[model samples]
Target: MREVTLTHRECVKLIGSPERARYGMVSVDGREPRRLTCLIVGDGDLLIDLDRERPIERPIAGRPIAVEFTHHDQRGNGGWTVTGLGLARPIRDGDKPIPMPYTTLTVGAFETGVRVCIARLTGRRTRPTQI
Candidate 1:
């Protein structure tokens, strides 16, 4: 439950990497949370797959949204953080004459996934510590 931001360059690097299973909770315009499975497309755009557990309403493009998730490296070390996502654009898969209601968002902002916690020390010298 932390806030994070990622630049367009960083986002491209992340999504361009090898495929992996990454899951996160996405909130659009402060609406109810929804489960999201993201896949980085060849163009570095995020193909967000929505969970069908609950009904999904399409989000308007250019709306502010936030996503929180944990990222894992090849060594399997990652932490949880919240990211402020840029404008959300709705995208559909395939070239059907009729369009689906799925959505895809671009990585347009940047934020670090680092969480800093402060603790009060009793009977000990106060020092800065990061968790």
Candidate 2:
């Protein structure tokens, strides 16, 4: 029997479009299997997607992700931010949590290949008068 291969590029394609319901699976050396049905649009600006089958449930769902990030903003004040992104699911085991902005998860074909980063959600800087 051949195993199903899900690549990072495939996940990226799913994120590019505006739709709902994608089928995939997550696997690891010693752990339970997880299935993912990522909904890209809906649930506000944030992308609603996750693998619910994890033994330990995480509150990652409904979390916001940065689609387009900007460093600065207009009037040289606060930056324009947009939070909402969708991507592949994470695969790992053992109850452990780190206090970092992002989590490096073991996923897909590469070792240390999958990175769940909390990117900055900022828009391009514009002059206040433009607003």
Candidate maximizing TM-score: 1
lDDT of 2 by residue, 1-131 (tens): 12233343433433334333333332232234344332222222222223333432454332332243222333455433223233323324311123211323222222212223333222232334434
Ten-residue region with minimum lDDT total, candidate 2: 94-103
* Per-residue lDDT value at 48 in model 2: 21
Clashing pairs in 2: 65-84, 70-122
Q: What TM-score would each prediction reach against the true structure?
A: 0.44, 0.23
Residue 103 error, candidate 1, Å? 18
Runs of candidate 1 exceeding 4 Å displacement: 1-8, 42-44, 50-54, 72-82, 92-131
Best by lDDT: 1
Q: Tell me the tens digit of each residue's lDDT in model 1 across 1-131.
A: 23345554455455434442245566666788676655444333444533331344544355655655444434434332324354455554341113222334332111211111101111111122336
lDDT of 2: 0.30
Quote the lDDT for 1 in model 1. 26
| Alpha-carbon lDDT, every model | 0.40, 0.30
Which stretches of model 2 miss by more than 4 angstroms?
1-11, 14-20, 27-30, 40-56, 59-131
Clashes of each: 8, 2
Estimate the TM-score for candidate 1: 0.44
Q: Residue 29 in model 2: shift from native, Å? A: 8.5
